[model samples]
Target: MLQILGAAHGAGRLDPDEIDERQNAVLRAKFVDELPEQIDDLPEGAALAAELSRQAAAASGTGTGGTARSGPAPAGRDLAPAWKGPGGEILPAHQGTGPERTRVDIMSGSEVHVEPGTPRVLSYALMGGSEIYLGDVLAPGVQVVVETYAMWAGNEIYVPPGVKIVDETINIMAGNEIGRHARGDGSNGVLVLRGFSLMAGNEVKLDPDWRPGPAQLGR
Candidate 1:
């Protein structure tokens, strides 16, 4: 997808902002099925889309968006979070035990990338913000939980395809923006996002437009 966007930029059809959007889409795309939708409208995008379709077909010969796991499976984990920082924290492959947890304090922002072997996560945000990116490393039929708390600040969660979410979050004078892709049955893993958003704007979305720094979490 990036290659196609680069070609479009070289052809003088896409501006910088357009290229950035397309690149972000590719990076945030969690499944092959979501790939074509990200770049099927730009110049020479038809060819790109066709190429992507071929790639998807090759990847998922079973046509389930390649959700099936081949070869031996790794050991599952009920991951426990080792408290890190107020800055971005990308979770390493699953290890350890206990309840997965983390926190972000005043004026700070952080990120947690969901990988397989890890279990439920508990996160806190107070006068600060955080972001969670769900990858497709989960085992089939496995459900992972993610709990969050946001107060006087904003929080964003990005989900990919095939993953299921059960959002039992409560809000008090706060706002939330949930994207279309975040809704689904418990087919894949379950991301039970339980939290409180008070006096702030919080969001649970799917494949959000990616950006740099704190801007990635958006407003």
Candidate 2:
């Protein structure tokens, strides 16, 4: 699947950013059924389908396309933390390289203000919760990716109004509740949120009513 996307990108059918997005989707895909959507509208998607069929035949040892086995999914990828602050400490707002800054909470909750200009974030919460406030300095047309995991916990993500949002979270006895609408202005960036929620819930809000404290103002 990635090979086909690479070919499309080399032929100018996909740009660097789109290629990156599709590649990420491919890596994050959990099943054969989910694979088709990632390349559905791409230029060489048909080839991907054929390739997948061939692989399916090989896997089944039947050399025929029948009912494919739906086995247990592989374990989730271990992403690095998103906040580097000490445990239980409120993380101040500051510019960062997205999710490369790790945030891990075992049994406590913390707050964070992510400065704009980053394109990606990876986070995890276990038996705890987090509140992330996005900064307002993002560039137009930039696409930001925020992936997270919540087990027996929840997350509140505050996004600015001008950006577009896509929710791709997969839930297991849990789900996400989005409280904002996509912006009509095409000049804003895109927020791509993907991850898992197990016995937890995640929230995405626009211009959330909550305010930062004096210590949480700036880094």
Candidate 3:
């Protein structure tokens, strides 16, 4: 059941809220019969095959529901405060400031390629992950704000050589790491990272073997 929810999220078929809603329903079910009936209630095309499979299993009385697990709770919607701007105004879900700047909100997963001349970015990740690729060159004082909340959520920013990074992020049971290859000589530009992370991690690295593919380049 959880696998179906994960797949739907990965395919962009379900947003975080819907995922959480269905997950809680599944977790709270008291019988195998309740599982398949709830599966039938999912949005169209979200889990057709899973619905059929679970229905068959329930008909066979394979197992009951609500079994206890011995680990941390499954990843779900976070209760962190809404992301706010520097002035303390709540930022919208998704928006772009200009042609060269963007605000990204990630719940399941996403990837972004930073184009040339782009100056700033606001990124928020909850219950999922995101990757930002900074191209080979950057203007001076480029800034990227990344906030990740909840367990298993993370962000990875790839930087090119010769570019320096200044990180100013608050972390609670979370942290950021800069890879050895990403250490810069301060000759290209300074990339400032700002934001907070809770029970998550952020990484800055220079992946020498990685390059944007055609799809990412086109975007």
Best by TM-score: 1
In candidate 1, what are the lDDT values of residues 1-219, reduced to their tens digit?
Answer: 455666677788887677666655665454555667766887667875766566555655645355442221112211111122235333222322434556565688877676545566666778887777755333234556666677888777776433456668788897667655455343333566677778875677644332222112121
Compared with the true structure, all predictions reach lDDT values of 0.55, 0.58, 0.53
Which residue segments of model 2 deviate by more than 4 Å?
Answer: 1-99, 181-186, 208-219
Ranking by TM-score: 1, 2, 3
lDDT tens readout by residue for model 2, 22-91: 6556544445544655666776787666555455555555565566653323333111111113452323
Poorly placed runs, candidate 3 (over 4 Å): 1-107, 136-152, 209-219
Which of the predicted structures, 1 or 2, would earn the higher lDDT when compared with the native?
Answer: 2
Rank the candidate models, highest lDDT first: 2, 1, 3
Q: Estimated TM-score per prediction?
A: 0.52, 0.47, 0.45
**Alpha-carbon RMSD of each model:** 12.8, 18.8, 18.7
lDDT of 1 at 148: 69
Better of 2 and 3 by TM-score: 2
The TM-score between candidate 3 and the true structure equals: 0.45
Task: Please estimate how well model 2 matches the true structure, expressed as its whole-model Cα lDDT.
Answer: 0.58
Q: Identify the leading candidate in terms of lDDT.
A: 2
